[model samples]
Target: MSHEHRHQSHPRIVARLKRAEGHLNAVVAMIEAGRPCLDVAQQLQAVESAIRSAKQTLIHDHVDHCLDARNSEAEREELKAITRYL
Candidate 1:
């Protein structure tokens, strides 16, 4: 398939993002429960880390499956853009 077609095809990534959304909601609940600041901070940090890890997994999948499938240098470079979030 063409790069154009695959550029927006992110089913696996959508799943990871959905999971991250659940993680985020849990963190919010922790805050509403009057948890200690340090504990909340830790949970927030874990959520951030989970999000980053999920993003990296999605990026790697895009590079190996989508970008590489199309053999497009541009798409491959776009995959590197995930580093900006780190």
Candidate 2:
């Protein structure tokens, strides 16, 4: 896929990341405020999930658009790189 096509979902990905950032900030505040451990953990879990979702979105987009244009060897290398996220 062309650069333009590959970046089609960039805005969405950025939005997710921004949300995760905000969630992380909240987690920090929760810690400082002496919130319950359970509550802090829950917020941390949410932040982790948000980041994971963003990662999956990025990998999926790469597979759908960028990978199609790559050769077999390059695709294998790319897949290897993507696996680190898993």
Best by TM-score: 2
Question: Pick by lDDT: which candidate is best?
Answer: 2
**Ten contiguous residues minimizing lDDT sum, candidate 2:** 1-10
Tens-place lDDT per residue, model 2, 19-39, is: 999999999999999999999
- Candidate RMSDs in Å, in order, are 4.4, 3.4
**Candidate lDDT (C-alpha), each:** 0.68, 0.82
Alpha-carbon error at 86 in model 1, in Å? 6.2
Residue pairs with backbone overlap in model 2: none
lDDT of 1 by residue, 4-70 (tens): 5343436766776777788789878988998898988887787787677767765665566644465
Steric clash pairs (candidate 1): none
Q: TM-score, each model?
A: 0.58, 0.78
Query: What would you estimate as the lDDT of candidate 2?
Result: 0.82
